[model samples]
Target: MTQSKEIKKPSSGLAARIFRQQMFIPLAALFLLALFNFIMDPSFYRISFDYNSVGNPVLSGNIISILDAGSELAILAIGMTLVTAATGGQDISVGAAIAISGSVVLRVLCGTNSRPDTLQAPIFVAILVSCVVAMLFGAFNGMLVAYFRIQPMVATLILFTAGRSIAAWINNNELPIISDPSFGVFGGFIPGIPIPTPIFIAAGCMIVIALVLRFTNLGLYVQSVGINESSSRLNGLNPAFIKFLTFVVLGLCVAVAGLIKVSRFSSINYSVVAKDIEMDAILAVALGGNALSGGKFNMKASIIGAYVIQFLATTLYKFKVQSTALPAYKAVVVILLVVLSAPKVREYLARIGKQIRQKTHVKEAG
Candidate 1:
């Protein structure tokens, strides 16, 4: 069973050339950010010793804050990546999911009506309940996007419309105080690393998802359906079921993001929480180089994009600039990055380019 094979290389490889040219934009952006930050604040680069000197393991320093914030984004991005790549859909409801899912956690575990003595239950109960409810929300999204054949964009719209409103309704539109000591653990830093607990959870989630997508049969099925559902179906794949599974996963992700939001705020908000979160996931997936039309999946790239977006925001905040303008600026930057990272259009253009070159050569020799 030991067969030797030669490594193959295409004669006309343009990928190397193109990737080099395209990398300039992201590179330049990072360079400029570093330059700007370095010129202004010398202390910005000083890594804090807060991680080791912390009393509460979670809220030690900026390192964990960034990770805590990233957990919400990371959770959302994983689902968004799945939706966009494997399920052939997108959801604007995740922002709503953040609110709805977290509201469920707060209300179920620490509702105002609960006996004051039992308001603070073990954190595990709230965590488990939040995850289950989140899956339900994701399943709801799957029913629309996968089973009904509704446009993925429109299908998740149902959640987009009323998800946050309902989340707000649960808490009477005010932030509910969570009194659970165990659940409160999530808001603190780890003993060693300055990283927040939420970040560790998010990192764990990323690892799990990445493993699932790589080793299991689900991975093959996902790429198959995303590449060509018709072909995969002819080959005995259940495209509908696979797609449904993915949306359910998406729901779980939204729920996780909502959980992170809750942990970050230590409460629940219906009116203001998780507003416009779908955009963050979309940007992360897009920037990660995942195809908009669906094909290869890049979980690592998506994580990087999430970090980049967060850092961009951090940079702006550290400079005392009006943060309100960030959304628009980030969007513009992302759109351009998407345009540059796009592989398909460039392939098509390259094909046409070859044809024209052949024709021109023929005319010159003729």
Candidate 2:
């Protein structure tokens, strides 16, 4: 019995260490969600291939839907994580920014017509134009926050309020629809591919960011600036530029997400496109155990949190939760997650774990 107890100690200690890691919160949330769905209905984990209307084999099921639909949110969460870490605040304008970016893509594709028989510009050209437009808008917000010293949420609020209106004004209050099937490939599945295109796009973005983080000092600079801007500046880092850079990077992310959104429908809805997604993106950051007030962050955790959120939504839908009531249900879960992830609560839990471990050792000795 003593030998068995000693052998189990190392594994138990390792698990406790893992539980104390920043990634633990999001991972635990994912596990719980998966377990809940498995308990409620094992079919929720089912994945099968089927041909679409275009005769392309594509994956289907609740799990696939979560990955497919959550792509945009995951992309946005990457940028949101950086912006939150650097600015110590959330950007409330991302949804509106997405609208503006999507509008730009349609405007470039449709040219002077509301419904175009053919694309006026190549798909790549439209995407590039939208990317520039989104980056410019991101720079504008960064200027206010970094240079003008405005609060991040307040600075972004300017665009949040008028972005949809600006999106409408971009195409003269017209809804532009692209008739090209090639454009749909960005949001849908490619020929002979069993997975959604957005998933690939999101994966590409993840790869790029991963490479950047691996090869550059961007992560270190962001964390240093976030932890202490004054100290970072004294250490030769340009705090202002770092902050501005994060927002610009976020804008680039917004452009990608907007492309997926408009491509999903092959059209733009000025007011309805990507609406209220900013809140979800922020929630993703929080759910990943990243501090709302800024410091360190886990990009992978935030991405996972994005998918977890999509999972939660899918679960609710499966249960026939009304769309209108979805936000309220999500809010309750958010509140619980936030409370449990709190530092005070974690410390308390750690204390209880230590005591339990000590008691176990005492009983074994006796």
Best-fitting candidate, scored by TM-score: 2
Scored by Cα lDDT, where does model 2 land? 0.93
List, residue by residue over 1-366, the lDDT tens digit for candidate 2: 334435687877777689778899888989999999999999999899789888888899988889999999999999999999999998999999999999999999999988989989898999999999999999999999999999999999999999999999999998888888999999998899999999999999999999999999999999999999999999999999999999999999999999999999999899999988999999999999899898899999999999989999999999999988999999999999988878899889889877777777888789
Q: List the candidate 1 regions with Cα displacement exceeding 4 Å.
A: 1-42, 51-54, 57-64, 112-120, 172-174, 190-193, 342-366
Tell me the lDDT of model 2 at 134: 99
List ranges where model 2 is wrong by over 4 Å: 1-12, 356-366
The lDDT values for all models are 0.71, 0.93
- Predicted candidate 1 versus true structure: per-residue lDDT over 174-213, tens digit per residue: 5667654445556555454455677777888888998887
Give each prediction's root-mean-square deviation over alpha carbons: 6.7, 2.1
